[model samples]
Target: MNFKPRFVALLVTLAVLVGAAGTYIGMQYFGDPGGQKQTANADQGAQNFGSLSEEEQKEFLDKVGNTDLKKVEQAYSVIKDNYVKDVDQQELVEGAIQGMLDKLDDPYSVYMDKDTMKQFNQTIESSFEGIGAEVSMVDDKVTVVAPIKGSPAEKAGIKPNDQILKVDGKSVEGMELYDAVLKIRGKKGSEVKLQIDRPGSEDLLTVNITRDDIPLETVYSDTKTVDGKKVGVLEITSFSEKTSDEFKKALTKLEDDGIEGLVIDVRGNPGGLLQDVEEILKQFIPKDKPIVQVEDRNGEKSRYFSELEKKKDYPITVLMDEGSASASEILASAMKEAGGYDLVGTKSFGKGTVQQAIPMGDGSTIKLTLFKWLTPDGNWIHKKGIQPTVKVKQPDYFYTNPVEIKVALKYDDTSDKVKNLQTMLEGLGYDPGRKDGYFDKETVDAVKAFQKDAGLEVTGEIDEKTGGKIEEKVVKEVRDDKNDLQMKKALDALFK
Candidate 1:
């Protein structure tokens, strides 16, 4: 997955900067309560504010208390005298208001004028009507880092690493990130054109995507075997609603399969709901075990406890990387502190700040940093991420191939099973170029060449409809090789 800064990091920075600005402004305006003339000055300022033109009003508001009335008047006079183009007074006033808020430097806090503000509120409720994809600026261009799983963008074939150059035929150059988001999001059923550049493709790709309601799924799981141990792999993609439920199902599958161990893959997962994470903890922890604690502004600490009565007995290993953030770190920390689990992979993307999405009366919302969270043992995994118990880097041999193979036939390159087949192929003797894990032309050629040598149809593709044909031939060739030891172990465990 593409790595980027976590959203929570930006939120915390914005909150601190904006809060300081608010404090400063409060001190300046309400510093002296004893001066009756202050009231008179405020009323006079309000009156003058109503009389000025848009640009003049903005200039007046900005210099209101900093300078005397004469200076304010002079500033407005200059703007009116030297203006080159006609400007809307209301827009100018709004822009000045926004400028003041922007000075706070909080990405989450801003004056969203009535229109944009409404859409902001919808995002917090998670009920936005638009193409569901998280976008950001990378290398000065708008890029789709990841389409929310099962969202319209994902359903429309948008993938991570796709560069979005244009939206609705308009270039995204010079457009603010917020503005670009607003333009891409719209009422449901509406259509938007995205000019995308996919990785390894030479030309730009155009995709017409329709907007739809995007409901986030925080948890997803599937059962698989590793070394014949009936290992269950549950991927908690994010911490959102239904996460605990999904986790329960994963545990149920393990129980049904009578698996001896499990692996939870949390790589590339940016966090969401905190309550969901706490609930998930209950499954692995015993009742009354402390999961985490949060201390609020008044120095009061709230402890979250696990409600699980009995813990799963299977040995568990957690897979994490830099993309595992926030609530993900919370869960990983708890599992490590509680013991019985081994963490494998890189350090987590640390983001311990908790943000409250406070909705304005209008449609917009403010994600305010409420409190910083800590593990039950009081370990602060904020900027410094959690260290894994067994850190293992992905093997480089998975990428580089020593030789290239040619084929006598063509195969379906778009089948979903191609990736798994490529992995299986690499496990055998046939070299299929780099395993970026796609059945590209190289993989297809290798497969066709293998098929021709095995006295099978020269098609390079493996289809479920035609399976067991290639597997029977391919598996027989290297069935007794030392390299096939892992596959034998997996098959033996399944049979046993």
Candidate 2:
């Protein structure tokens, strides 16, 4: 969270590209040789620009020859006099600036008009009003980076990588990122209809989200008894300004409750401040231990360290998924390298670069890439994400379409359906040995054991009735409440 005074911009995952120089730039009157006076609304002092200081103005005029200056004046006069309607000087200036930035072709570099700049600052301060979802411009389209957990956006099923096609029935194609965000975000309790194009689906889905002030609880923890041993479950929804503080408090509460092990979940986290993550890692890592190394553009490296006096001794398991990115990956990598924690879940969303925001005097800001982050061991995971120590991909049926229970499955049946059955059986306490598609003798015995427990026909083969029962149990154990098979596996690895 420490920012250099000259570069007073925030590190943000959902930030838009803003274009800015060091000072205000107001337009001059068309035909004054001495220098035209700027006459914008006085109320927009910060938003409006005035003529440069005398020395700077002389320097600029000298740099651009008088011929080019005359040409610019002629163009301005043409637009002012020949245009059918009255032209707003501010709009013309802002438009010209936007055109220049568009040529950069970098989605992260943007031009923020006064209004957009206000919203951008509000968001950076973390007190904005809108549907809680992190968004970024990807492939010239407005895409959802990640929906905040338990927010209206997430509840409405706005998923990561969903292409937003329209807002309130208006096409947003080719619109500025800030403009698209402004259209999508609205007053609390007001509804904004988003046309989403999700991957794997041909049809465009309309998701209506009722905007609200996002809930700011970034950390949650509780203790659960697993095989008579107390295990702490610490789930971080996302990193925020106060995330490290919240994490410390959660860990203190868990310690007071006497936990024997820990499970850290960062499943849908998009990421936030780099300092917050470093502080969180400090709690479990020993003093002076390297957490991560940041290499600047010139290849000069700065290593961040843990400030803790002693490392925590309990076994820790980190849970991650495709949505976990940036600081989440930073914490995961540090914990694995320095604390020797076990990582369980799918590959992470790899985003390893660092950005620094530079605020301009004209109420605009620019976020520029400044560094590339690496793991404690110097491994770079930019486009290539970190693989988990124990790869446990969450079953799709837990949140999506139900697994089809087709023909009866028994010993010698070799198909993906049998694999699903075996995985479910193992999840429900039956020892199927392996989850490979082949239904061997071990699978048949596990099926018979499940039948006997469920009070069904105790046949070794899975019948139609048995398949339905298995599906029901799988739904109950995995879906009816929430997906916890990954968590169960983590606990099994830690305790049993």
Candidate 3:
């Protein structure tokens, strides 16, 4: 499935960066927020012609002959006369509009129906009632990009890259992402069953999740005493309308706690509002510093700048992974350039384009990619994601299956799975040295510490009991920080 940024797009995995000057195409004056007739006029011209009688059709055609609309009229008349069944004129018109945009082959560009438009707006506003998860159309399959931390999907063991084989026992093969999401999300306390396919495993996994009200609290932070140094960890889940305010509150509280360093975690963060990111960056970046640069189709360039003069001088690190994209990338790139922060974790999702959600006069909306963004250093990391200064990749099973170690992992063992154990250890407050995949002396020591704490035989080897304990620790810490490996590295770098 395609990796979608969390905020700028749809709720079930789509994100857009809305920063630079947006050219609004169609602005509707007034309508009910949840009204169905909001998109009625988008294709009304063709629909009106389709409803006319043979003589009236010709007259209408003649009336529009002097304009470019005659071409559309001719096509509609042909379809009306030759189609086997009586077609829904409005549907035909909407389909034509969608087809036109489809020809562009841009995933970010989409024609949203009234309901979709409403839902998309709700997501941007940062409040929704659903089973929190980011999903996207990956290879035409409904795939799970990442479950929101503390969300029902995450609690149900839904992992990144898990394909949706069925929803509520209904096969979702070849289903559009937006449509599938609509079916999956419902009122609070409602149940949604999903059949999952993790890439490396052959057996399908089923998860029954209960939907709830996913809050708009995008930023979370707390101070931790690491190696006698005051360290603040700020977790950014998604950049939403409320993200900037939340970030400020978290930062202020951390400052009050007298933190000397900071870590910003954006792992599995699909990204949110671009302006929200820009506003958050203002607190860190110096006034007048370039935050991000955007280039339009005509080669016109615009740079967004920070507005705050007061800046924090603490050493900072950012945590990221393949699930981070768009606004998250913007924040990571800008901070790395302007604030001299080091990024730890694997490369990001690499979405560098900007999209605008232009509301049509009716209820529908056309979300189109209007420009490409560049990092403060003028780097375009589209497709090729932003690589971390310190590259750390978690074990595959860390995402697919956190529990149930298939093999006995002892000291000197080397594999991606070992790295997974190390990551979990670090999250549970044990220092596993480094997430280097190789089981070194530090890893053994950390494992032994964990075993002793769990009332096990204090064995350095990761046996079944040891592995189960590690999984429990990891599951608990995951909601606190999006990615355990990245967060551990950030803390280690600051304290050690």
Who wins the TM-score comparison? 3
Could you list the CA RMSD of all candidates, in the order they appear?
13.1, 11.0, 9.9
User: Between prediction 1 and prediction 2, which has the larger TM-score?
Assistant: 2
Backbone collisions counted per model:
7, 4, 10
Per-residue lDDT tens digits of candidate 1, residues 1-496?
A: 0111122222222322222000000011000100011111221211322344686545433533334434434644455456797665544544444454456444323344455544443443354567766554445566553455556775555654467778889887766456666667677888998888766544466677888776545556656665656666677765555667778877787678787776676765656567777777887877555788785655567877876777677677777766566677888888888644667777876566664443332333333445668887887787688988776544322222111123222243443244445654665556777455566778877777667766776667654322344444344443333433322232233233
The global Cα lDDT (0 to 1) of model 3 is 0.68
Ranking of all predicted structures according to TM-score, beginning with the best and ending with the worst: 3, 2, 1
After superposing candidate 1 on the true structure, give the runs of residues whose Cα lies further than 4 Å from its correct spot: 1-131, 136-145, 150-165, 186-217, 225-233, 245-262, 286-290, 293-303, 307-311, 321-323, 345-350, 375-496
Candidate 2 lDDT over residue span 1-496, tens digit each: 1223231221110111111210000100011001111222422122211244566435444544456545545766677678999998666656655554576665544555566556544554455567877766778888766777767787666676788899989999988777777687777899998888877544476777888777667898877777898999989976666888999988998998889999999887877677778888888877666898998766778998866887677778899887787788998998888878888888987777765444444565444445689999888897687888989977654433123444676778887667767777877789888877799988889989999999999988887788778767875765333466678778777754
Off by over 4 Å in 2: 1-87, 92-105, 121-128, 287-289, 399-482
lDDT of every model, 2 decimals: 0.54, 0.67, 0.68
lDDT of 3 by residue, 1-496 (tens): 1211211122111111000001000111011110112122332211333444687546543543434454555677777678889987667766666666667666556667787666665555556778787765556676665667668777878776678888899997865456676678788898888888887554576677888887767677777767788999898887666778988988898888889999999887776567778888888887656898887777777998877685677788889888787788989998888777889998887777776554543566666666788888889988788999888876433563544566789888987667767767876789998887899999999988888888999879998788877777676655454555667788787644
